[model samples]
Target: MSNRPSPLNDWQRHCVRRTLERGGVIAYPTEAVWGLGCDPWNEDAVMRVLALKQRPLHKGLILVAASVAQVEFLLTPLAPELRQRALAHWPGPVTCLIPDLQQQIPTWVRGRHASIAVRVSEHPVVRDLCNTAGMPLVSTSCNPAGRQPARSGWQVRRYFNDRLDWLVPGELGHERKPSRILDIRTGRRLR
Candidate 1:
């Protein structure tokens, strides 16, 4: 294999960040698969991702962050033990479903649910993407509903073609499966 560190370079990363800032949807590598991402706070962008995935609004979406600070806004109302429990698994492949106490998250991101899923990722590209964008991204598998997730940059390109504003070049992290979902309030493992 070539020694290329990742599918993206500094310039490409910058471009992707700009695209996101402009309400563009993008494709990028995640811990277990390629993921479609957009600014979580942008309704139109999030809608595009939902439409692109052919997923229903009630299914909700995931938010991926580079650090706890990036997602701390969603954890503020949780009980200290629950917040601590969720934080203990951070910077890794774990998606925690925390109650949206303030209801500040948009309906598009939360869907019809009272909780929103959030993760603090250790994947270099994912972290870089979130940090560069200055916020967590609405992250979902890079494929239509009921289809296998894209695992490579080529697959992402083929799947979305020119529809995506950018295909962030990167490789999947070591995770062999999507992040496990945990219900923070109930202390239950969802997946």
Candidate 2:
């Protein structure tokens, strides 16, 4: 596994990073499905994600990170236990709904919710993508609202059909379902 080149070759990584910096959306593999992602801070890029998915803006989005450190700006203000609670699931497939107390997350990502959905992904491609991007990327299943999430690169191409700025080539992780979402405050499962 260590011999693998962090999912993308240097040149491929560069192009993807450049595309993201320019407010472009990309499709990539996640734990159980292909995902659409863009720089969460770029409203235009985010809007394009919603448009591609034919999803409503009010539905919000998930932000996937390479590590907990990338999101310390949002996590630092929480109670230690709550902070640890969210951190404990790091570099894995659990998505936690953390309170946006500092309001650091933009409304476009938070949508109508008071909290933000975030995950520290275990999938190598996702982690590498986030690391290369130098921050979290907005993550949502790569399919139209009513369709099943794409589980293969070919499926991703069929759904987006040259629409995405880049498609990171990789395989999905060993999971049969999307990450389980939990509300950090209530320990309630949301999905």
Candidate 3:
């Protein structure tokens, strides 16, 4: 394994940029587990992630960001309370279903639902990746459904290998479980 210490390292960033530019899937560390992601707007890239995990499109996908601003494009007009609620939990492991403003978001992303799942990640690598990519990415646990999520870059490679375009080396944050998913409108936990 390479000894690079940060996601911003030249070689690591190069790998991420190249794979994303080519509309390819990648695996990177998240708060709880490794996550598979790609340019959310790239249908081909999104399809690759779905196929790799044998995930149904109807289940939808999550978008992870460096900041709430990166995903603001997807949110509808919100009440002050709602805005504060979101702001209070962001930059952490909370995924919320917010109103989808741009009806143009592909079904492969929003699935059969009208809202889109989004999170402003606290993990440094994930945050930096979204910043570097200049857009939110389709985020999902780096494993097939019914399986445990990957926790290391090697585990990611072991699960995907040549099937993925790249595996961004990094460490998972200090969480033993996956992120909490909530319905912003209803304030209910989905997962």
Candidate 4:
């Protein structure tokens, strides 16, 4: 990652960080679509996201980070080659599921699985949101179940309206679709 700050201005970053700290859900742009996010450790926030999506808790959520170091606790235990493989596609749009072997991630984020999906995003707004919040944020498509993921801020507002605490200003990256998901342990593409 670069030493420079994220494109989000100081005030926007401050508000985003504060919202996450207060367990408020936010909507921001991602690699291919707008995303809803909140502090992953806050069950209330996570549950709120599930509720907004009309998604069952068993469906799980993805965690978006500013850097690999933000997820070292989950990555450190993997075999070196496996770790390398997972790292290679990151700082970009690929989401990979790593075994939550120690059960470190909350059940709300991991759902019924023994793994959690994560990505170190290259999207400026995503990195800014995660970095401003000082941790990974629960990232799910900003649409109710069965709806197409929102591709613009206007669509995000249409889908969620006043329900979101803050809508971080930004645009989607160049990716034409959502990140491809893979199970790192099995090399299987889940999406």
Candidate 5:
């Protein structure tokens, strides 16, 4: 067995960095499956992800992060209870829809929703990539809306070889499911 410091080797990180710097879309491992991601601030990159998924822009997307600070700019003023509730389940497989501040969030990122979906990811490669990129990334499953999510780099390549600018090889976490989503304001389960 190899004793690499991470699941991603240096070459993979290099590719991830280059793709993100150029506002490109990448397929990478996530908590339960592969995910397509791009700079949240890059409209073109975000559009590419939507196009690759054959998804409608009005459907919006989730932003995954290494920490709450990565996504703080997109959130509105929150009550202490709401903030605590959100914090309680973060750094894991739970997504929460927080009130959008509107000022920092672009229409493309927010879609037609009044809130933005954000998750502090527990997946190592995901967290490292977000932290390295220095911003939250627009994240969606690496597949067409009606299809199953890509669970491996080979599957990602099959689904988006020409469409995606890069692919970061890594292993999915132990979870056999997608993240659970909740609306902070209403405490409603959205997924």
Candidate 6:
């Protein structure tokens, strides 16, 4: 098997970044399947993703970042030892719920909670997109509320059609399951 990335050209990356910059939702491959993402700070964009998935806002969404530092603000409020634990497990597929201090996280991103779900993604395109777009992205499985997540770009298109502003071309990673979401404060595996 080749290690080559899916043919996502520089131009397409730029286009997707611009779309997110303008508060548009995009579909892209993740560790397990294709995911729909938008600028977490953009309430309207986050709503668009929720509407696309037929997901209730109160269920919340995950924020994927290029690096732990990109999402450090949310975890900083945790106890020093807890913060270290969250940091130690990151730069991977684990999503951790961290307390959102400063309340800087948008309600749309955190939903009806005081904590935010966040991960420093190991996927190359996701990292590049976050680094280029300059913020964490609202990440959610690409499909309606009850359906299985789309596993390929074709599947993403079938699910969303023209609803997505951009269908970012890429291949899913080798993981068979979604990231294991952990509640860092309680040591509970939420999903």
Most lDDT-accurate candidate: 4
Q: Candidates' TM-scores?
A: 0.93, 0.96, 0.92, 0.97, 0.92, 0.93
- Tens digits of per-residue lDDT for model 3, 36-119: 999998999999999999999998999999888886766537666666666767878999887675575788898999888889
- lDDT at position 120, candidate 5: 94
When sorted by lDDT, best at the front, the candidate numbers are: 4, 2, 1, 6, 3, 5
Least well predicted 10-residue stretch by lDDT in candidate 2: 1-10
Global Cα RMSD, each model? 3.7, 1.7, 3.7, 0.9, 3.2, 3.0
Error of 6 at 43 (Å): 1.1
Q: Model 6: residues >4 Å from true position, as ranges?
A: 1-8
- Model 2, 1-191: lDDT tens digits are 12445878899899889999999999999999999999999999999999999999888999999888888888988999889889888868999999999889888889999899999987889988998999999999999989999999899989989899999888899989999999999989998
Q: Candidate 1's residue-wise lDDT over 1-191, tens digit each?
A: 12325445779878987898899999988999999999988889999999999999998999999889988888888889989988989978999998899997899999999999999998888888887888888999999888899988877877888899988876788989989999988879988
Shift of residue 78 alpha carbon in model 3, Å? 2.8
User: Ten consecutive residues with minimal summed lDDT in candidate 4?
Assistant: 1-10
The regions of model 4 sitting more than 4 angstroms off are: none
176 Cα displacement, candidate 5 (Å): 1.2
In model 1, the worst 10-residue window by lDDT is 1-10
Q: Give the higher-TM-score candidate: 1 or 3.
A: 1
C-alpha lDDT of all candidate models, in order: 0.88, 0.91, 0.85, 0.92, 0.84, 0.85
- Work out candidate 5's RMSD over C-alphas: 3.2
